[model samples]
Target chain A: MSRNLLLISTSTTHGTGYLEHAEEEIKSLLEGKKSILFIPYARPGGISHSDYTAKAREAFERWGISVSGVHEYDDPVKAVNEAEAVFIGGGNTFVLLRNLYANKLVEPLRHRVLKGMPYMGTSAGTNVAGRTIGTTNDMPIVHVKTFDALQLVPFNINPHFQDPDPNSTHMGETRDTRIAEFHHHNRQPVIGLREGSMLRVKGDGVKLLGPHTARVFLQGQKPMEFKTTEEIHFLMDAY
Target chain B: MSRNLLLISTSTTHGTGYLEHAEEEIKSLLEGKKSILFIPYARPGGISHSDYTAKAREAFERWGISVSGVHEYDDPVKAVNEAEAVFIGGGNTFVLLRNLYANKLVEPLRHRVLKGMPYMGTSAGTNVAGRTIGTTNDMPIVHVKTFDALQLVPFNINPHFQDPDPNSTHMGETRDTRIAEFHHHNRQPVIGLREGSMLRVKGDGVKLLGPHTARVFLQGQKPMEFKTTEEIHFLMDAY
Candidate 1:
């Protein structure tokens, strides 16, 4: 059994419907699977888990795939174990990880995904599929027992990675600067997945997908840009 | 003794020298105090503690005030207890809090500030002066023992808060939405301090200082905007 995943940077892009840009990839990833266990723990915009699950259901309904919110089940760990495919929506990473820990679903979900169950995540969801949630852009609205994640991927994923606009006057730290700061303390490689960018992993192979180029940050090195057509599979061996 | 503090949203604005915008406020806050203790734990841009303290020293040299980096002292806890004035510089909030806890300075630093020591903080420094660092915008490069902060003020502070840009195409969550999501799990009020803004705390009174208006977020109420001249002391009693 090996990893089968589609980790997206964002569910929706500017002026696009939810999951519209990744509809093709989503359909391809869930080709034979009829139902997906939707983990709505992220709860974007403070929406309830049920409401968030409904939004995911609507999105997957186009392909005639049934979706169930994990929280709806009496035993979330059992739900993850029995799930054919799992999808985690984007929201607050700290809150999402906290709930994952509280429900004791982290190990079950990780085992299922690592055992060849198809897994899809966007934004905060993708952040948790990495080695840790240390690279997340979301505010720490809540505290988890640890910054640890599922470790489905070797490196951390920084979703919605924005390029510094030379014309802007805002003085906030740029995405690159923040990632660099993370490197100062930790030695993990970080992938800055821009909007519309994602990574596809199947067994030992990994590839960058979508139109944009992704930025890679290594400890004590300048961040470099890599395109979707490049041989990015070597990133899997970096760790 | 009562709280005597200056909490600033940012150390420098665009096209301005470090601490230039708040020079007057800094001078007034440190009136008759010749020297101050500087906590350079934030370490923005991966700069060293000595370098960060040197920057603060140069900034205060204009006012003939001597500055000492707390890290240079043999006993950081004792330094915080005996310091006449304490300043925490802006950088990474998680790193700052981690160092504070590692060096056993949280209790002493908070005790001194709560006992009427003149304290000043900028950016990450200001975030810790609140109930918790849950509202910080900085990246979580390191994990602290706790998200608990000074609790000198009643509500959490979201420093360098930005309003949603109508013309921007970026799809990231706005500051207001993030703070609103925080309200879903926590009951504490959050003060969204925009750049160039500072809160002046004297005894039991807190006044909004600076030219721009500040945004306040309550658990069940809509966010409200208040100007510098407004009577915002009611925030001190919310907790």
Candidate 2:
């Protein structure tokens, strides 16, 4: 099984231009690909798909690559079948997955990626790359038929994971507490990717990129932290 | 229509005993009722339902009132129908709603509450009282059949609502941003209740209790802040 995936925590970081922190990695992932298909269904800040696609176009054109939104074509499944690469920008995970199922693109997209077409996603996009969207931080603006996601990876992804702040006064559940709660009902391992962190999976191996360490959560065990330069097999292998 | 609902933002506030902060308001709501049927299905922090019910039992017993978990009865619907009052404590909204649907308690609970049974909830309990559980801050640890909730109130509730921090370095979406995104897909108004805040509904009148102002968001209009003493007609009346 040859699979290429770039799962990112966020599209933008604090005080940085969009995708600026992961620019080099993104370009390298798209090397030798003439054009890429963009899925903007997440619609950050409730933006329209076309407007969101324009933002992606502006970013990728800088790297001498042309971008086309999947919504621009009449047959989205056909677009995925012919695309050289696919990129999904982040927003609301529920909204993205609902639209993905609505267009019947989940299976077609998964099949294409299994054959080794490069695929990359950020935030909500990255969340859908996991087994289920059950761990998303986004509000359920709308409900999908099911929580079943792409299953590109066996474990779930908790994008935008932040460590608990000892000095904070907010009483809302912390990210760690939320993921721990997920394990009570679900058995999948969860990779908590902090800002500026990403997971690159090629074939059976996975690499953690960026400067921060990724937090990994499994059922019945304490969470472990993985640095940018470590090999974690449980992350890439199906549990 | 006569509806007695005490929608609480949280059971506990910063640096306080559980339900200690809202004890007076809760006591006022439950006066004359000898007992309360507690739905501990939310199970905060993955605690057992009996343990959560024990917490509620401890709180109400202090006020000369008694509490029993719905799970204690083999027929939850009968327990709800025969109960003098109902209380749902704080926890994950997704888990809470899924269990509510699984046990077939949604419609029965709604009917009993509409018949003038005193009903109260905190956090996730507060969230399910709205038109839908679409505005909760909790993560989706489990998937529910629908975002459709009890619709006890016309508007949705964003409990534990916090304003955007001006000096924070975090890149995650703020509470305000998340609610704005909710309005893009859903047409219902959303009420943002900060900690130590609650809603009191009786007959055709609605009152905001506690100390903080509630933020009201309607489609195609700027979010308006309403004080505890303000008259909010659109709140009690279904949109």
Candidate 3:
């Protein structure tokens, strides 16, 4: 079986409702699937696992897709293994990875996705789909056993990547600088997916979705920006 | 024996010279010491360890205080133990922590610092003075053996803490929200030390130092702001 993945930069852009911008792409990717097993381990600030799950459920229910939180199952590993489709929502990457390790579902989840069970991730969710969680923007609130991630994709994904505003005077490092620093210590290519953008993968092919340009960072090279319409499948083999 | 530590939020403010803003405080902290040890493991971007060390050396040489890069020594553990004062410069927290572990100097450095050796850290260096590196804003370009830091202080420190720019359209979580999310999983109090700010520690007493107000986040309570002159020794016992 071939793989299918919808790795979104963020669930929502500023001033938009949750997952609203990616609704059409999500519908197409999850077409004909009755439901999705939601991993709510990344729980955003002040939200419970059930509440986060309910949020995911509400988003999918609008399109007539049922949702079940993996946390609600008796065995999370079994739930991930039997899931028709898996959807990991946005939040803290460290907590999400820690929970996945605790549940011993990292390999099971990866195996299912690689075997063609539909997989989708947003923000922290999307971060785990890459080579490692080294590019995450989330705070490291907890300790994970390792930085190794699912590696469903060949390159790491830096979601919600925003370009530096020329007018700002903040002395802190920009997103580009951070990714460039990552390249100093890592050889894996990193795709900086801006808001409203996503990577749609089917089999061995991938396409950049949405309207914004994606920034690509290669080790020992300058970062380059690519329009949404560009063919970037070469990223998978460019390492 | 008591500890003497100076944890600075940033080495420089906008448009300022390197370590220029805190030069006076740094001199006072290292009073009577002829030389200091510099750990440049937090090398930023493409800068080499020697270059980063040279930058620190130049900053301290202006005050007649010499600097020796710990990386240049054959035995980092022995060097850290024999150092008059230890200074860790700012950059990527993960890389700094990784090098500390790789050199097998985490425990040795911590022991010396706790035994009355003066210790100074800026940004990433300050982040490691806390119990763990959970509140760092840097990208995880590499994996450390553990998030456990030197624990020279009782609580976690969020260096270079900036308030949200209301005019911006970016939807990423602010420093406050990130720390709040941290409290959801941890009970440790986090001090959001802004630029141009620092903490001066002497034995069991610590005083906030600088011109800006530091933000403090307790687990469930609202974040409170404290003036630089306020006595914050209670933080050591709060958790």
Selected candidate, larger DockQ, 1 vs 3: 1
User: Taking the tens digit of each residue's C-alpha lDDT, what string does model 3 give over A67-152?
Assistant: 99998999999998888899998899999998899999899998999999999999999999999999999999998879999989
Residue A15 error for model 2, in Å? 1.7
Considering just the first chain, candidate 2 attains a TM-score of 0.98
Best by lDDT: 1
Report each candidate's C-alpha RMSD, comma-separated, in the order given.
1.0, 0.9, 1.3
Q: List the residue pairs that clash in candidate 2.
A: none
Chain B vs. true chain B: TM-score per candidate: 0.98, 0.98, 0.98
Runs of candidate 1 with Cα error greater than 4 angstroms are none
Top DockQ model: 2
Model 3 chain A lDDT-worst window of ten: A230-239
Model 3 chain B weakest 10-residue run by lDDT: B230-239
TM-score of every prediction relative to native: 0.99, 0.99, 0.98
Backbone clashes, candidate 3: 0
List the global CA lDDT of all models.
Answer: 0.92, 0.91, 0.91
lDDT of 3 by residue, B44-134 (tens): 7758999999999998998999999998999899899899999999999999999999999899988999999999999999999999999
User: Between prediction 2 and prediction 3, which has the larger DockQ?
Assistant: 2
Score candidate 2 by TM-score against the native: 0.99
- Give the 10-residue window scoring lowest on summed lDDT in candidate 1 chain A: A229-238
